[model samples]
Target: MADNASGDTAGDALPRERKPSNTALAKQRAHIENLMQNVDKPIELPQPGSKKPLLKPPPEIVLNVRGSSAGAGSSDFHTYRELRRKEHLRIKLMEAEAAEDAIGEEFNREREALKRQDEEKTAKNRAKRQKRNKAKQSAKKSKPAEKAALPVADE
Candidate 1:
């Protein structure tokens, strides 16, 4: 059993009644709908730019000097020095190439000497084999003579 505010007990088998007020319920529902209407939607993101925006000024050529060696040097003088350095490098490269050629000739001579030694070794081996073969043949021929000189004996 459940008790109402008046101290009267309601039957457990019976459902409790809540009086419905149409005006009040409708106003509450409208207030909720108004709150829903005021809710914020998600914001859209900005699109990517097609071209990059300029951020800083373009680079400029600036001459920096630290010591007395770097004095009022003109652009023409700089270019001339570069050309002279290149010419010197070319001369050094030619000298290096000549040295390389000389080394290559030395290697070629050594290779030829090794080839000649190999050929001589092979010829010596061939001659040794031929001599061994001749000695074997002579031994074979002497076997018949030894057999003929043996005395006959009864078994």
Candidate 2:
């Protein structure tokens, strides 16, 4: 083997050591100091009962329906039961749809009632304001007529 000037073989090379910068060393020292301060303080753990959900989704009344996987034109008992299962699922879906529609109709009726009530209130207020303005105008018109009726000396 040819000898190099450093007198160390390439296969026996040691890893180069590194020294951290002053800023990094200071940051590490500060982190350790902060950790030491927290060592005496008790860690507040979460309570087990707090894991309960705040709100739960509404229960599903209608389930998803998948088509029958049986072979076509087969009139076995499995196929008959599959047809019955589909009928039941369809009935459940119809019932759920009807229930949702009823809720929507009720909401619309309530909104319509509220709209009519608001319109009536505003119309009454408008009528009262018109009457008040007309009264004020009539009082002003009478004052001028009364002054014209009074006999006055030439100024």
- Find the candidate with the highest lDDT and give its number: 2
Q: How accurate is candidate 1 locally (lDDT)?
A: 0.76
> TM-score of every model?
0.43, 0.48
Task: Give the per-residue lDDT of model 2 (tens digit) for 1-155.
Answer: 35776688775787667765579778899877887899987666776785322433333663533458845454556766876776677677668778989999999999999999999999999999999999999999999999999999998
TM-score of 1: 0.43
Query: What are the per-residue Cα lDDT tens digits for candidate 1 across 30-110?
Result: 877877897885445799885523333322653543466665656757866766776676667668778889999999999
Can you list the residue pairs that collide in candidate 1?
none
lDDT of each: 0.76, 0.77
Worst 10 residues of 2 by lDDT: 50-59
